[model samples]
Target: MAELLEQRSSISLQLIDALLEVFGEFNQLNIWSKVTKDDFTVKRFDLGNDSNLCCCQLTETAKSKLNFSSPKDCEGVVVKFLTFGDNGITDNGLSLADIVAVNTVLSINQISPKLLFANSKCYVHEYIKSRIYTFENDDNPEVVKCLARILAKFHSLDAPISNNAYKTSQKSYEDFFNRRKHIYGWGNTEATGQKYLKALENHPEIKEQYYDEFAKIDYHSEIVYVQNLKERLDSPIVFAHSDFNRGNRLVVKDSKDQLEKIYLIDFDATSMNNRGVDFGDYFSNYRHREDFANEGFPSDEDMALFLNEYREKCAQIFGTEFLDKKENSLEHMIDEAKIYTLGSYIGGTFFGLMWYQEAHDTGKGQYFLNVAKNQSRGYNRLKKRFIEDGTIPRILQMPK
Candidate 1:
């Protein structure tokens, strides 16, 4: 316990140094009324993948002016620290992109936590009261509809960002495996790879059925295939929160209406892509991580419920007969989302590999191993259904 406390103390000091660097000794920019050395407490915010990211909530210890439960109250700031790799450079490009994405979301009249300050070492955001949206325990269909409306609002944005959403998604998929080549020893001499392989030796089927089969095809080709299909079907390219999983979603209950309002956070992977990719990404993450519940993935009826609201919301927002045209009807978008679901499952398999690696490193035993297994199983199940429905070719043929 002594060692642990010492390590935490060291981390707290480092974070304090970073914050002081961003906001000078006297808090010249007036981010807070007064910036005292021991006026704030630092605690890590346990959200998102912590492997490469560091998020912390710095709460003021002094008295505040507003009520704690009010939606408008901001008692603290969430800080995302920049992690510098072996190479001297930091992930500033991604940080800048995220900042741009946050501004874009705010521009659309959507709710994103306000940005207080930013620098190369860390960026600070006004911390809003919110809890991560969990799809399992919070099984309110109204939440689903609200999420759909929020997503439509996002997709309707003509944000000034790269239009390479498809390429971006595919690249993310590839990067996962490339990372594993070293982190989990996919094709390297790293000793950690041996440990990874040894852990999964008993599950030979995972390699033969999922990883090996998954490795046989190029993901870029798969992206191309869907891109062509979406183009032929008139799928609009719009701003998308490419990583719109449930964890990135936050909820706060309105004190007046008592209805839950959705707030989206995290935009490191935002880009202009086919709207279906966002839907696919969102829908594929329905299952709970702990139990790996299968029922979490929305049913056809649930999809219809969400998509209908989305279609109408788009029509309302754009002031056109949006998606009501003969070619681009609600049904077509539903089918398109379904088609994109295949890509999501493929991504899920890659996520499973990542989870396994994280688990191995943290000595979490077979907890994440089961997560990987369930992910591969989910992907195969969805792929089988798609193949049987004649939605896609049995083999994801490389684009010519």
Candidate 2:
């Protein structure tokens, strides 16, 4: 472990040295050191007192330890190094347009980390103002509602010049299906046709078979009048945080226990998509984290509370009349959320099981195998709940 940490530190130093070439005039203008010698210092940021996310801090002057006692400890320009092997870094850093949009949101109520510098290797941002407790992965209801309200405010903001909507997540979902299918040895061996294959030897109702009905659901183009007044809508797709996991939702509060600011970090997955994408993420993915002992998948009543809180927040920003459209789209949004939640759970479970059995990474085999079973149980339970509560329509009854 020490050797691994040493190697990581060595690599980050190399990256910072290389990044200096990109910083050029800004390094001096920003008072950031270009050399990794005595002047420049790099240390792994102990985010939330845990290292699940590898974050490193680079300082201009020699500062070995960053004081985290208070928000004031985080000062001036902060350069953070985020490396995701090879696929993440590109020849061009964060596009100027993306940075502008990120900043616009932050300007409102600290919806995200302010993007200060960007290059092919990583992003640099103003150090977020918050104490360690504020940034912890907490499951407090107030924190959850605060996060939801912040997201509402983000979506309500006037679009930035470079912030027009675009769609890539659906394609990525298809890619995940392909990768999980291939890893499980259940889909076509071809490079591009994996997504179309059907069924697993053990799980016949998985993949294509289970997803076909939901796949037919098209919110925008194919609109069917299921009921008057509450017709399913293709709600205006907006900028979405593709990965709004627990780790990314950081919060800041005042001495009065009032929520001050909640900072959304890690824009690596930022994209333009239907808001349902974010809803689905919070509902199924983030809620399952170990921190959220409140509820695994928040109960319908709890989810309703979240929606109500979000609607109230939206009403404040976009006006009471604005909520009518959201209300109309509520059913469809929940539908989208369900489809995504189901697919994600099943896909993740299958991947774990396949890795344990086929890939022979047996070191964590039992744990993953049990995780697969637990996920399956959770999925089945949620499926039953949805069917019973009529949160979603009967499987074969919906339009094919």
Candidate 3:
């Protein structure tokens, strides 16, 4: 046992060393040494236990290797190092890297040059602009144009084959959503409602009201609704950034209030899926349903202008039929978006419930559970809107 532990320790050190070698040195010393140079300052942080995976930032000296001039308002390049445990999923880093690469390509092609670097232990990405938080508030046309262009670019990337080293095939949208359901052991409306009920039982004050609303749902009625809708969706699969929220996107504006550039970050949840899935994430993450309903979701005028611009750009880059199916494309897209929205809610709730349970054991679960409950309420509200707006019934009409 002693010898085995020693071997493991040695391997860990070697991994760290390998990472440093790829990232290069910080000043004259190694990354760890440099960070700990001032003992008193470093003592306050528990860097070693900051994350489940081994992670650290690259020093400015190390970032100098990229040969970029530091902007007056810019922070230095930050490289995050992470390693999976023996039982943990290994493809996470690679998937994230893929998203970064794809997004970088799109941004550079349509906007300006941005760079992404990665090695086995870490991924490094740099953006010239500030991150954009809410798309609704961002009025920069260039930013909007760049976003649409990147989405088109992302859709054009080659789908992962089963034999690829990165296991892109495993990153398919269907696989991801299905795996999510399996992991949570909940399916359909009834199971989902029961799960919410259980979550409420654990946190009555935060979840009771929401649970009551969910409990009133008619699960059997939604069966035909879901089954019929499944048959109508025959859209071709494409590469999608499964988590294309505004948080993952960055934007830069000119003095005239025109968007100069936009950058997409955090590709950890990217995968091949329907375009509607990407749009759903975009809408939910950036523009909450309440905001959309009150203000009118993206406005028909904006959607029309954005779609026209997106289709034109995509046709130039890929082909004329890049967003084909002229007759019912917009409606189909909207329906798909609704599906993804509900799907996100269901998936998020399950994970939140699990985190709450785990947090309870560690005495830190209430906050996370509260977040889940709130999100569940939001999703339920959105679902109700979809039903009232005839969106749910339309999806229900889809073929299984």
Candidate 4:
């Protein structure tokens, strides 16, 4: 253990040096001597706390890397070095334009998650603002709207499929799903379900109804249902940012107290999937907490308007009929959206439950457990809605 830690430390130092050397040769920034060399504590906005800082990169380098030509350059550049336990850097140093492009794609796709800036070897992203507690008062609504607009504009850009190597992969979707399953692991669903079940068992009276609902479910049956549903859906597949959520979106507020811009970050989970997956993400993230019981997730009446705007934007870039026709196509899209929502809820909840127990036992953060609980609730509401609206039967009856 000691030797491994030392080796990691040495590698980190080497990486920092390499970054400095590369930036220096470009006449971008001067590398200062190492001021700190400890475990880098990952923070929300900045790089890890223990990251080595050098003079800011040259104005031109920063401008070129970020793809912005600032009239004035002030302050120094700080290069942060980070080491993941298992996941290596997926994206590294990126310019502002790269960040913008990423976010633009996400907004157009309605994919949300923390925005990540990356180069060929390293990844950079904005620090998280704060731990989110209540979505009600948070700037979520304006943020969603702004994201919708940005996504519309982004999808308006010519498709960059030629730039990505994975676009032509044969088993892209399967590979993508398997990778997610591995990263999430059995710890997300099975372990989590056991933990929550134990908790509910301990507090039977307080959580009786919740317990009863879960108790009636059969895990194997659920799994089979999902597998069968996947085989039945005939939605056309497109390149999608698979892990879309609010956490992935970076929201910037303007002076008018409205959300001005949204940046989509994180492409590690990017995949080719149904467009409905993106819609599911938008609905899942934007739904009202109270509406969870009724399966009436919240969306601004403007959501349709936003979709229409996105459609127009996509048409401009992808062609006049990029999406299906506006009228009949919208209705079909809504149905597909519902199906995708259910699929995501079920799949995500299962993963959550599997991981919950291990996370709790290992004293890992409570994040996994919270995700499990929230998604479980979402699944229940979605199922109920499907049953009540007769969608479940219709889905089951559909030809595979």
* Candidate of highest lDDT: 1
True-structure RMSD, every candidate: 6.1, 8.1, 8.4, 9.0
Off by over 4 Å in 4: 1-120, 125-145, 152-216, 230-233, 287-296, 299-303, 323-328, 362-370
Candidate 2: which pairs clash?
A: 93-119
Candidate 3 vs. true structure, TM-score: 0.65
Q: Output the worst ten-in-a-row residue range by lDDT, candidate 3.
A: 37-46
Distance (Å) between predicted and true CA of 112, model 4?
A: 11
| TM match of model 4 to true structure | 0.59
TM-score of each: 0.74, 0.66, 0.65, 0.59
lDDT of each: 0.59, 0.50, 0.50, 0.47
In model 2, the worst 10-residue window by lDDT is 220-229
Q: For model 4, what is the error of residue 61's alpha carbon versus the real structure, in angstroms, after optimal superposition? A: 19
lDDT comparing candidate 2 with the true structure = 0.50
For residues 1-400, could you state the per-residue lDDT of candidate 4 as single tens digits?
Answer: 0001223323455565555443433323312222222312211122112243222223334345444433332223323333333333123222333335554455345444332333433433223223222245233544545555555553334434322323423233345445545653322345444334665454445355455555454544565565565456565555555555555555555667554445565554454545666667666655445322224554334346545555655666667766656422555555556666766666666555556444545554244545555666777777777678776677678788
TM-score comparison, 2 vs 3, better candidate: 2
Flag the better candidate by TM-score, 1 or 2: 1
